[model samples]
Target: MNEKEIQTEIESRVQKKLSDLFTTYKTDTDSLQAILKWKPVVLMIGNYSSGKSTFINELLGQDLQRTGQAPTDDSFTIITSDGSGEGLIPGSTLVSDEKLPFTYFKDFGEQFISHFRLKKVDVPFLENMAIIDSPGMLDTVTEKDRGYDYMRVLGEFAKLADLVVLMFDPHKAGTIKETYTAIRDTLPESSGEDRIVFVMSRIDECDSVSDLVRSFGTLCWNLSQMTGRKDIPRIFLTFSEAMAANPESYSEWKEERNQLKQKIQSAPEFRINHILQDIDRQVNEIKLIAEAMNAVARKGRAKLGNTAKFGFAVSLFVFFFLGVILKGMTGFPEQTFLAALLGGTVQMHHFFVPACGVAGTLLVTSLLFTKWTFPRLRQKARNSLGNLITLETDYRKNLWSKVENRVNELLKNMRISEIWFEHQTNLGKIVKFLNKDLQEFYERIRKIK
Candidate 1:
């Protein structure tokens, strides 16, 4: 399908899956409304001191986000499109300290904390596309508890991203592995519609133009090897500091900056298309799995239902059989024994009493057996049902885990060329092979049901 069509399909699938899950909890209405009004989200992530904040300022064409000569030990500074920045603390808000001016390195640590309560910011950018300015990874001060908390939050938010911009400093070029690990460790295999783009930030720090180009090339190669996505786009070198320092000095840099802006502007739609197709595939997989699991559960429930009916029928049959046996043995009617039993044997004349004795014995035996034996039967049936439910749950979980692992491996092994070709190629043989594989997967799952 074309990009727009694919994107529409993906959005539809995502909406449907979200709708179904939320509907189970009766919360689909609000979620659906939110989806309808959803905007593109771009997440800015990189190691600390990678000029991420500086880049944000450049992007906004103002010193909106804090940038300084040294690294600031702040948590995430989420700048939304609305031109508002706020600190995000774990479970509280500092309403009294809203719109605090960006701080420099000298203003880091508890000094800043004392001035502001970290509350999430809702700004104009949130209306169309939200930009998350995450704390740098691998900061020198590792002991800070808040940094770890910030890392955790960033990881959780990674799933919400449409694109991830990995900003790298040329001076510390060797830490790309650490950078990739920081991101990969936190994100799930199924994070939707996200693309990782490397940015060789602070390019002006390079010795010369040639040095900058070489550095960018090396960065691209290293990232390609590390990510196993050789077809992934090359790194985009940026000099946010230079751009901020003298917006007019480098016309070429300015042109490049504009190009990057255009790329980002178009990336949301580009990614949405791929994400939509992926989501459709994922939804189909999930539906098949769910159906199989439900089938197993239904079978177990049906067996339990039958067992319950059988137990009831057997109990009644036993009671009736006891009545027959008592009538045959005592030469007295079952009703006489019941009446005597109800009347309490206080006036028993010997001959009549003996006549009711057999019925009483048989009735008492049946009652005792039914009371004692049926509990074990019921317990067994319940245990069987419980075991089936547990089995089905475990099976589904394992299957999902396997799928996740396989997909992750596939992504990790994917060559840059393959990803590019995936978009470019229409080789009939490869298409046929993929179709066959998909069919095989469906058949295997059907067998599982």
Candidate 2:
């Protein structure tokens, strides 16, 4: 067979395997259908205030996403093809219900509140692509939660992307290494290395044009080498603020941005189409695993049932034998005649005594062993199976966690936001005080390429 034919065969086999696995779980066929009908989802991820929301707005040629100086605590804004985007807010249902032009986070005080809104302009982008604005990685929240959010979004993004665009800011003195590592780590293993793209934003903030170009070039090279995609296109640079605030100052940047847009527009529409194939593969795998688990459970239940049946049969035999013995043991005239006719010295009174003893012993044994011992054993087996399930869940969670940590470590070095200290007591001061070594560590990353 030819190379293309071989690839098709392999994909078909994999898909069949996944479908077989998933079938045991009783998952709906339609659930897999949604995944198959994947759209190109672009996730804008970076540190808080790294111009992610702003850049998204600029890309759609409108202020669809909320942009401000305040730190956005909530991370996810899902813009889909339906002329709407949903923001998953933390506390209030109202925030979740309100429709805004784009999703954004605004400061509420010591507690960072999350809000979701909808916008119209992002709808067109969503027709072919789902634009996701993620929460900033370096917010003051717990690293675990941030990591979780990042990994979740990354997984979703991976499923949707024909290409991934990694956005960065260069004016800040920090490393791009961490960001690059995050992008690399979060990418799905199923995706070949050629699908990711890098973009450096806020180029207008750089000291000089040469510095911007040099930094961007170095970042592109380092990222390419690290990710083992040396042949991928160079990182694209843009002055997003200039594009937003004063379009005239950076016409070149604007042009570059447009070219990137063209690239996206012109790229092959295979990713979404390929997702249908992947869904088939995953379904089969899920079905297979579920079937195996079900088989084990059924076997265990059947074994216990058989043991119970055997005990019941033994009890009935003892009861009948005891009645026969009792009749022979009785010294009554009628009983003696019956015993004589049977040609046996059946002791009417004694017969029952020994038979009952045997019956009682058997009953005790069966009750003790089957009712108590066997039940405990069966319970242990069930528990073992349950533990296995738990372990499997934990294993998947750990794998996802590792991926998230790698991504977060990369984001920390990107210097996506600044800590303003107008008042004597700002949270940034506290962060700086605690993370001295970590900050230095990230600073070193800035010089890598």
In terms of lDDT, the best-performing candidate is: 1
What is the lDDT of every predicted structure here?
A: 0.49, 0.48
- lDDT per residue as tens, model 1, 152-249: 34443453455777887887777656656555543433432146667777766676678877887777787777665656565676776463555444
Predicted candidate 2 versus true structure: per-residue lDDT over 235-269, tens digit per residue = 66766645355545566677777776765553335
Q: Determine which window of 10 residues in candidate 2 has minimal summed lDDT.
A: 415-424
Which window of ten consecutive residues has the lowest lDDT sum in model 1?
A: 97-106
User: What are the clashing pairs of model 1?
Assistant: 10-276, 48-136, 48-137, 81-125, 82-124, 82-125, 230-416, 231-416, 231-417
Q: Residue 221, candidate 1: how far off, in angstroms?
A: 3.2
Supply the global lDDT for candidate 1: 0.49
Q: Model 2: residues >4 Å from true position, as ranges?
A: 1-18, 22-34, 37-39, 81-125, 139-149, 172-186, 241-250, 264-270, 273-449
Name the candidate that leads on TM-score.
1
* TM-score of model 2 (CA atoms): 0.47
